[model samples]
Target: MGSNALINKHIDLKNKKILIYTGNSFGLNARRIMPSRPKTADGILRYAKYNIVGLVDSTCSEKNVSQVLPDLNPPNSPCDLKQAGKKIPIFKTIKDAKEKTSANVLIIGIAPKGGKMPKNFIDDLVWALENNFDLVSGMHTPLSLYPKIFKAAKQNSRKIWETRISPTELPIASCQAYKIKKPIVLTIGTDAAVGKLTTTYKLAKMANKKYNTCIIPTGQTSIMIEGWGISVDKCEGDFMAGAVEKMILEKEKEENPDIYFIEGQGSLSHPAFSTTAIALIHGACPTHLVLVHRPLRKRITGCLLLPVPDIKKVIELAEKTVIPSFLNTKVVAISLNTSGMTDQEAKKIIDEIKNKTGLPTTDQIRFPKDWTNLFMGTLEHANIRT
Candidate 1:
């Protein structure tokens, strides 16, 4: 008896390479049937999401078709399911459909298999094409999702041409397949206007001097991260979990270094910035923290508060009042995010943080003439690499 396939009626897949496989289409009551593979794009094609029948069984009536159809999913943002009820397309033999409709892209969704695809399926498909079908293609349905079907595309004389499709070299096909294992160096920074990104960048640069540095969210945004000297291939701050996980994975794959120093994004109190605190809690979350502060503080009333009033009080507030309660860290390192803060003001904050926390204070990176070069452009001691 003949049967039909149900698929999205839109999106054309005529005269194009098509691959249909088995899976969600598999009916417990039905036997596993192999779908046809076509070479080159031809014209109209029809397919069933079920048993991979060599020559589809089209005798099955519409009532019989409904019994084997897969139900629809509750639509999300992109797949507008609310307005239009889902259309589960049904087709008899793939060849019959090729003679009927115009579909160029066939992304089939199927079930699981133990190992190899059944034999003679390729030859049977080639013969079908002789009857006027296009590239006997495989349906890349959900069954082949991720690593399962990543290597599904088999090599036959026809597929060998592929018009020259090249493979990419990234390791993370699935999170489990990622290839990094050592601690990765991280860096973060913000813009000079608020000084959050600026302070973070300076710290990242300093940390790079001693360790194999790694940059996060890879780009020239005022907010940036760097490792050793090379910037990361990519970076993003908006998605905290994704950013942290990516950095962790990236670092785990590289060579283990003495340490990883991650720069923060913004001022802890500033609505837009909490960079230092963020890196400490998320990216690097170091045992130590280099709190970059400026003498000039903008009050709610828009006034500039100077000398930070009393350095001792600020120190006491940071250690006893902060850290253990806020960041929950021992407050091991202190660094200045140099600002219009006079040298004396800078020294005061540094000394206060040190005396109170008993942590060492680090230097700051001032804005150089060409800030662009400080970012996108590469930087080296010139003599060291040469």
Candidate 2:
């Protein structure tokens, strides 16, 4: 928590070459870091992705890097992409492309169609230049196997660029436990008709039906998920939940189950969405933490750090930060959007989480899964939304 602390927390970009690989779908999402003229339709950040040379698709061919990032063209375009993002010319392979271009950084980010990482627009440039992390995009690399990815990078003496900072504090006063009395769900979308809102509504209805609860609407103009408020701007992303969180807490009481289910506004990487997420956590402090990932996690963090980096160890290290003094409670449910996965895969991910950290696997839940109002009707607790 000192100047030295911030200085010590660096990306370690000294002088080394790196090659990051990710899976096809999951990995492809990582490459969507750069923007053409604007990353998002509404626009917020353009600086974070300036350093990315180009996106390369390994599934097609190794020489793709040169093709996509051609001396005159873009990088390799992935199989699932819509050709909307900027591309570089493909080379025989990244190695060959590097040999021709002499580029020091090599990263791979690919994910399945519609299952891409919802990461920041400027992730690649920021992490690549600021942090000493090498990038790669091969779905099976880190997930199933890809020792070569790290081995090659380590042999080149480059550290993977990914780190997370999670701060926890025991809430000062348990405001009120958020219970799903009637399953008041809310979804806000970037688009009007259907976007993330529809997805959120579906989730809410599915959960409500399983739990036998009523669905509440709380969007700008929607008939689904009933709520007392509707957020105006979707480009800003977090409006849906931010607006609803305040409303639910106002009406929630000890006797009634006041479950406020708000949808995340934009992709996680979207700067506005990221800002919105920060606001929602600080403003509402929901009983649960649900991250709607865009599948492009590798580009930003160099790894998908779920449950946010060993909370126990982090707590030990950051207790001095004093979160309990600000927020008034503890105990949270972290839900992940594992929409494109099988139960076995989900279980494996959960198991991996447990193996990496001592936290109970139950604390983290994968998406499209209905908990049936487990959080509701439990106990109402409040944190002094700081």
Q: How many collisions per candidate?
A: 83, 95
Q: Write the per-residue lDDT of candidate 1 for residues 1-386, one digit (tens) a residue.
A: 01221111122222243333222233323322321111000001111112121213333333222233321222211112221123334455555545544332233222122123334234434433334332322222211222212223221112111111111222221222122322222322221123333334444444455556543432122110111121111223333423444455555467444334443443334333344334234433333333444434434112234223343343343344232243343333344454446667666765675576564553334322223242212222211100
Regions of model 2 farther than 4 Å from truth:
1-229, 232-246, 249-257, 266-270, 285-288, 291-296, 300-326, 339-343, 354-386
What's the C-alpha lDDT at position 273 in model 2? 38
lDDT of 1 at 251: 59
Candidate 1: deviation at residue 217, Å?
4.3
Q: Let me know the TM-score candidate 2 reaches against the reference structure.
A: 0.33
